[model samples]
Target chain A: MVVAVAEESRGADHARPWIDQAKSDYWQLIDTEHRLEDLYNLVNVPQAIWIDEKGTIVRPPETAGSTDHFRRMDLKTRTLLPKDQEERLAARQAYVDAVRAWVTSGKHALSANAVRANLPRITPEMAESRARFRLGVWLRANGRAAEGDRQMAEASRLYPDSWSMWRQAADLDEVGKASSPAFWKRVQALGDKPYYPPPKF
Target chain B: MTKILTPTAEHDVAARDGLWMSPADAERVTGWTLKPEGMCRAEACVPLPASAVGTNEVDLAAFWARLGGPVIASDERDVWALGAPADERNATLEGLAAPDFTLPDVNGVPRSLSQLRGKKVFLATWASW
Candidate 1:
């Protein structure tokens, strides 16, 4: 099954279009508050976590954006975004091919130990940041907007490398905010670097 | 400022900031009231350090720790999480049984992860930005 966690504070309302267009045959979840982000330590978009039938996490969370979306990005779309289209498309296509091999292989794919080795390590700093992020979400949901914003800012400060965390809470009701600007600048700074670590095939 | 009065102390505090508050509000939040001696809840009372209390605000970091709760704040010292002692974050990673959560579906019905326990789940998080 598929759980489409819409990383929007506004809940499912913010993620309706993508879901409607997909016409997916699997379960689609709307993670309006980003519980999965905090739960699974999502640092960016298009990350997926695979759970086996016995409730075992054979594959941990990793960048899993669709290769088709990038493959079909026409000239108009290419200029609209800041990306090295050729390089990115190659990496994404390679990733798509690898995941297909793993998923289609199923029980014969890899041993539990091999998949476990691919999981990302949660450092002390990231752990604390995750806690603070979760708290920020909880506080915002519990009628503490100002406090929640402060916590969200802390989460960003503690883990500045995560675009997902920063952009998720960016775009304030007030225009010209710091969050959006910071996120954009970082993306520009990471011109050729791999924003996401290599996923486990 | 929240006005709170308990059997032993009475004061006001900015309850939303998690910074300083009256002894009563502190007790309201953590169930531990401030008294002439220290913080107390129900029958048990613990003596608070004289340095812990300030002219107006109490040291929440020290106080939260004394209650045996794990206190985590953002790098700015503005936001804090003070509920679970260890956060049990490692448990989620170690066990891998997708953490339980509830969110509104397309039709606005609240759906939980527990409902899909018996099945293999492919969870993916997306964004507009």
Candidate 2:
């Protein structure tokens, strides 16, 4: 189950062409309201959860095959250096191997206790930020764009970790700010912190 | 009229004195209904504080906070968002049940997580951005 967390209809429409090109057989859904953020505490794209036959969450959200290597890539050419590309591919391959092993024999599934331990802690400020984000989306949809923008800014201020919340407002229109100079600035701001914390395998 | 935003829906109802809505509107805004004993949804009921209940309206902020949820209102007081508590949202983690959601596929057809029951799911989220 692959879901595109595009908070607005225009964003979803923009992805339609590429989704159509994929020609994949799996379920591809669109979440225009960003429901997964509130429901699962997802903070970034390419995050994944593993569910078993009985609907139990065998694994909590984790960065699935994504790395921060792009930050070091050449922006003008939009390409990673060969060595970095190799490292990125190997990391992604390892994640894919784990997924395959788990799907094949349920070999890598975490125990329920482990799953609980892996779940993200939901703080009061994070919850309030989500509420503010919702209100911002509503305000934007209801002809109050400036108020909505302010609401979203406050939401980002309340929970700085949620880039998903930040990006929705920053990239509300066509040209995306997901990879703008501002985004890179924020990334560079994380001097000692890892951008994508490695999954606990 | 005050607009209350829930996870699933947006409700416009008459409000007074800080998010007090009629019992019927409260139920509509939130799934929980105000009863003689307390506010209830499904089989769960939490007794409301006396001050939270008025002659004809329930104090939404008070009752929501009582349920462990958080309530936030716009500066102008025209819009509010009632958020589910961390406890309720994380219940799926503690209980080991994956939260089920329904979203539209690329073709605009609605699909639900429960529909994929009886199979292993690698639920992944991506962004067009």
- Give the number of the best model, judged by TM-score: 2
List fnat, each candidate: 0.57, 0.71
- What TM-score do all the candidates reach, one by one? 0.64, 0.93
lDDT of 2: 0.82
Evaluate candidate 2 and give its CAPRI docking class based on DockQ: medium
TM-score of predicted structure 2 = 0.93
Q: For each candidate, report its DockQ versus the true two-chain complex.
A: 0.29, 0.67
Per-residue CA lDDT of model 2 for A41-128, tens digit only, reads 9888778888888999898889889888887988788999999999999999999999898988887799878988888988878888
Model 2 chain A weakest 10-residue run by lDDT: A2-11
lDDT string for model 1 (B28-129, tens) is 656677777677768877676877776655665567666544566544444455533323455557665656777767777677767777666677777765
lDDT (CA) for every model shown? 0.62, 0.82
lDDT of 1 at A132: 64
Docking class of 1: acceptable
